[model samples]
Target: MAPYQFIERPTPFNSKGGSTLPIFAVTPAHIETGTIDPIALDWAKKAGYKAESGSLLLIPTEEGHLGGALFGLGTNPSEQPYITGKLARTLPAGDWHIETAPLTANRLSLGFGLGSYRFDRYKSEKSSAPTLMIPRDADGADIKRQLAGVFLARDLINTPTNDMGPNELEAAFRGLAAHYKAEINVVSGDDLRQNFPLVHTVGRASADAPRLLELRWGKKGHRKITLVGKGVCFDTGGLDIKPASSMLLMKKDMGGAANVMGLALMIMDAKLKVDLRVIIPVVENSISANAFRPGDIYRSRKGLTVQIDNTDAEGRLILADALAYADEDAPDLLIDMATLTGAARVALGPDLPPFFTDDVELAQDLTEASLETDDPLWRLPLYGGYEKDIRAKFADITNAPAGGMAGAITAALFLKRFVSNTTSWAHFDIYGWAPSERPHSPGGGEAQAIRALYHHIRQSVR
Candidate 1:
């Protein structure tokens, strides 16, 4: 069977296929105005569907067929931008179209498409999902491009570590470079030790081998945008092993790398006018005698000596090298994404990622973009006073702060030390996976903050 297709061909105004199911997005105030068809209104009233927030009421035809679905948007429709996304899963399987709604047709269409995503790579039987017909006035191209980037991230993160190790990530990285004619390079194995010693130290024990992947694109004179992602394909906590429960979701440790590439796809696809560079310290933090031990000291690519207070803190070590590499160029913007700390998740919960930046203008732009794009981010203070938290007694910095108080802030400070040249640098500590299903996001690997960053860049470049 053909895979689910999201964008449909342009149709006449208010056009819907015969098999297409209508979805009515209504608010409580609108419902009381006697606007809905009497039959649907009667069925809805009897079913206790008061059009409250997040409520769903299925309408039946006179012949008892699946006539349509009524989705509640509460008092304010904008507050429930993603409410219609639920329709992709809840309503019976068929083509779906929006009959009435306050949201832009494009946003609603994108929400529906995002909800249609399912990871069936290892499944024996794949279930069919309800498909959405792209609305006539909607920017189908933009929606498809964004959805493609998002699905790329979701697929990469959802794959088990067995199939998504460093080597496979390199292949995917290379594939993206080849698609856009980007300059790509990879330094792996012992070669990594010569320059990126920290990256090599953390990944040496894995069978797939450790590597630094680089991709550069766009014209040289354009504004330079550099992205560094922690590509710990599967983090097993190294010698300092995590408990079985903690290690269960290690496959998504590479979510930062996945998201970086996903955003790269959007930048290239949209032909955004900027020079882009993506650096990923792709590695697996696996256990073996060769694994870097806790308390070991290693020199980073940036020439700072680091002491591994805990082997589980390997992501920061690799990112230190990559961010240092990115900082050397002193691009217009430097952003690094990582699944850095559990403290971040505990502080902000799963939905909102915490970003650290001293540049006020950059922070303002990101805040506006986050609001505009619906990709939420919260700013966490760099707290220069906490600089001592990451200090190493014998080395330049400690990978793991001993007290673990303000772990997230200390981790951000640890990364900040490597970034001296770049003035507009921000670090995003993301959960990378949704703890549970949301209206527009599935349970597995979810892309965070990239859309907002993309919007910021798009505006900056123009």
Candidate 2:
């Protein structure tokens, strides 16, 4: 499938022929200080343009031709850093350049590119996007690389389960690995049963066999950064089953995998001097006569028996095995992203996912990066008091705890049990779906936390 059409890097702006339109990112203060053109300022007073956040006004020349535009930054531009995203959808299709802004060029350009994304792979008609001449001060390649990663993730998650099943998802994974020239391997069928028993169990009932997909890149002796993602392609909630409304968006169950792929792309594209590894447990949680039951106990890859208290909780099951495998390597940094629980959304909502980590420095770095990248994330405590909730009476542990209190934390603790070897490890419980349209992001399968992770990882390694 073709990639999403994003903002372009245009030739350097020259005012000789008036070919390009200038866009001023103005705050309320700028408007009051008469910082804008006198003609545009006079028009603004007549038109009642207060320069509110995300508001746009087109400036016309004396000849009645489109001359320029003003994008409002409001009084507190920092409060809405990516407010320029509105321009991507509101601007007329034309060559434009940012003449002035309160924020960095990278921030404005990335926001525009992000808002320009459209998943029209299945549409009959294509949409046209306005072009932006990347600012001279911006890192054009960096912006493009991040945009590609985000778009790749959104595309994968937005695909319907019929076209995004285990097989198709693996193909996409392989395609990415091939593009980056990374070594790839898969363990499936009977092999998966022995190597990743929990993964095989969760994915066994689907028509497509479940598998463990692994990719390795960069030199072996460098700072090792291993990523694990939950890849339940289409979750029917297994034998437990979900209400029709709940299952409608289950196709995004594999959003965790999509996000990790995005982060991996950014890491490889920048050629960060660090050893990178990705482990994804790809599966479709379906129901059948032979489907793993709520009472069934299966041995995990870590040799721990897990009782299926609720088959609906399958993401953490597959992630348990993958995390164990990743932990065995004892990478310098181990990170796992999963759309594992609705409780995460309950706690922090879909926009700000909660992450759990024991490492103080990792938490601080991720917090700083989250703010810097505008990829919001909140750190939740791995409370030891809740450890008893995951304990099983008949087995080593239970996949789902009763009462449903602090569900997200318990799920993280369950996965944390298998990650004993890794010193710096963090788990993100992401909703992965945007409930409604927001500035710079459309409502669909969304990329959460990866940008922050990418920023933190890149800075730490460098």
Candidate 3:
């Protein structure tokens, strides 16, 4: 929560509002046609501004008063949808408007608000960025709601493991449920072991007991939608352990839970006509005397025995139970998201997450939504050939395969075994953390696929 403010139906220039500036986004074409303001043109020439990407210039009148400013869009302005986000940090702490551009007011304002985000929760002091006063035509409220969800996810993800353990994660989940007036049920510790053995096995070592968190909202008879998230709050790799470098960002192991919370926020805020259920198995994969060993075998909630070939692959174990639970009711749509495998990151890198789903229509809708929202997702085949890879002689299945080939696919295949009843179920292997900065996103905890998924849901609801 910075000093930024979004005003609806903005008023024109007036003496009452001090130091308000007008921003004109310019492309190479605009420069060639002599369409820009004469004052700004003169300033650009004097300042050697080429209207290249990220270029900004302010014009001064004869009386030394601020005239207007120019922003560069390079070859295609639409490509950099959130380029205007820079205006919030670049311009002085005051009101500014996009005078002309190929972009919509909603996009411009949304970018500004998103760019202004800072996870200074632990910081001593926070800086005040310039406020972006949006136009009346812009969908300010909707954008605000979406960003709120993203920020909520980011805040939860960024918190260190010490403070964001299983109990704290349940608190965050409960907070969201309370805000939306949803009913919440939590089965924790020993009860989890009895009902969700896979979830309990993965989290048995941690002092913060493992919990199966469920929140339900909307009418019972409405189109049913169930969301399952892998809430590994902090993964220390259990008995197998991890290298120091690999453990650094393990706080984001619960990214799947964070993302689901974000998507749930978007759904509940919009009052979408659907019964929504969120299932998160909040746990921390820590090491101790009680930690589940890699070779340990345990019976899962779905009545299938699992041999833990790798304790590091515990995310899928917890999700297996949650997914099985979700499948029992056979909802209209079921989605499970998790930072399940580094193989996914190796294949698609950090920004482009991979999703697995058998439904052709669902995949097509999600693909279009990805393009529409600029939240990219690649469809990876759930090859039945790899199904044998997860099969184990000792148990019904193994959490990890022996060959270590096609890890993402094998993980998806393993999860697929538990989801027999759901008509439409998709699995998302998300990085959950942005490796670097983007136009609208900072480099911390990133909300992946939710925007695109929201678009897909919107279409489905309509």
Candidate 4:
């Protein structure tokens, strides 16, 4: 599918000979007066604008060309900005500009540009949706950079698992590296056994060989940021196995890898001043004679022995090795993401992911970013008390506990053992799929924490 065209300038008066739509911000007070002041007042009056949030009004222009649109945002002194994602599907195809508002030009541009995304990859019949044009004064480069990352993540996640296997994921990473002139290295098959034993064990059963994909960019001597993602391309629970119903959406098991790549795209596109390193262990946990069995013990890259209490708990095994490798460099910051546990969803639901971190200030920054971006995340405690669940009698730790309580916390504890060197580390346990369609999000592979993480890193690190 062709990528959507995004521009970042002041609102254009003409959009390829199509009608130009002016979007105005409205309030309850303005609705009573039947006028939006700066735009057309009479049209708003006739439309019965009540200034209720998300209300949109379209008025015909004096010329035969398409007219403008007025969106209602309830009046509150500190009301959040960019609450109009639903506009993506509602707005008619044409150029649009914010005519009246106090929002920062950057925020306004980003809000509209992001709202325009649609996953039309597999649509047999093409969509005739009209493209929205940016204003002349908007920051085009930044808008394009952000949208590119978002669309990249959406496209990768939207593709079904049958086509997006472990090998295919590696190809996507290499493709991105080639596009940006970044260096790429991949360790697979026998090489993985020698170097990334845990990663190999988790992915050995599938016909596709498991691999560790690495991409490095930027010059030496810069502050380093290492990203680790659990790339279980398709998990069928290995020998432990999942019921057919439970495994239906297993294709999205690699959501963590998709998100990291999305963030990487944003950082590189914007030329953020940091040496970025991305490590993903791409594997498929399918059932076969070669698949690792429950109760099997494997030595990890960190030299800690891990007992596989349940083959279904395979995400952490791959991440354990990748996290160990990431910690070896002791980067300035280490972040790992995965669709790890259902317990997280039980605690915070699907919309809000739980993040684990030891740094108070970093947690505060992430919280603020989540509020600002409307991408909510709740901080989950590392809870030192839960550490005992991961300890193994014979090995350093066990991948899963025989008892099922605190599944998410135990999983986090398992990954925590591998991340000792980094001073500030954050782990996000995300449910990558959206069960139902909403305004900005369609029901497929959703980018759970991408926006919040992007904002936090850009503000704090860069």
Q: Quick one: best TM-score, which candidate? A: 2
Every model's TM-score? 0.94, 0.95, 0.94, 0.91
Q: What does candidate 3 score on TM?
A: 0.94
Q: Per lDDT, what order, best first? A: 2, 1, 3, 4
Instruction: Arrange candidates by TM-score, descending.
Output: 2, 3, 1, 4
How many pairs of residues collide in each model?
A: 0, 0, 0, 8
Better of 2 and 4 by TM-score: 2
Clashes of 1: 0
Give the local distance difference test score of model 4: 0.79
Off by over 4 Å in 1: 1-19
Model 4 residue pairs with clashes: 9-135, 9-136, 9-138, 10-135, 10-136, 10-137, 11-135, 22-68
Model 2 C-alpha lDDT versus the unseen true structure: 0.88
Model 4, 1-462: lDDT tens digits are 332222222221234423445677667767676556544677776766666766777777677555777777778513646555545557776556667655566665666555566665577885544355555676777767776777677667777777788767888898888777889999998798867999999988889999999999977787788888889988899888899999888888899998889888888777777899999999999988888998789999999999988999999999999999999999988999999999999998988899999989889989999988777799999989989888998888999876888888889988999999998999999988788865455567877787887777787655
Q: Give residue 364's lDDT in candidate 1 (0 to 100).
A: 92
Error of 1 at 28 (Å): 2.3
- List the pairs of residues colliding in candidate 2: none
Q: After superposition, how far is residue 235 of candidate 3 from its true place, in Å?
A: 0.6
Model 1: per-residue Cα lDDT over 1-462, one tens digit each = 222222222221223556588778888876788687677778887887788866788888989988988888889878757777777777676677778888898778878777777777678997767677777889887888787788778777888877888878888888788877899989999999888998899999999889999999999999999999889998889888999999999999999998998889889989999999999999999998788987789999988899989999999999999998899999999999999999999999988999999999999999999998888999999999998889899999999999879999999999999999999999999888988988887688899998888889889999
Among all windows of 10 consecutive residues in model 2, the one with the lowest summed lDDT is 5-14
lDDT of 2 by residue, 1-462 (tens): 533222222322222334678888888888888887787788777788899989999998889999889889888988877777788889888778888889898988888888877777799997667778787778888888888888888888999988888888888898889888999999987689888999989889999999999999999788999999999999999999998999999999999999999999999999999999999999999999879998999999899999999999999999999999999999999999999998989889889999999999999999999998989999999999999999999999999999999999999999999999999999999988898877788779899998899899889888
Model 1 lDDT on a 0 to 1 scale: 0.86
lDDT of 1 at 380: 95
Every candidate's CA RMSD:
3.3, 2.7, 3.7, 3.5
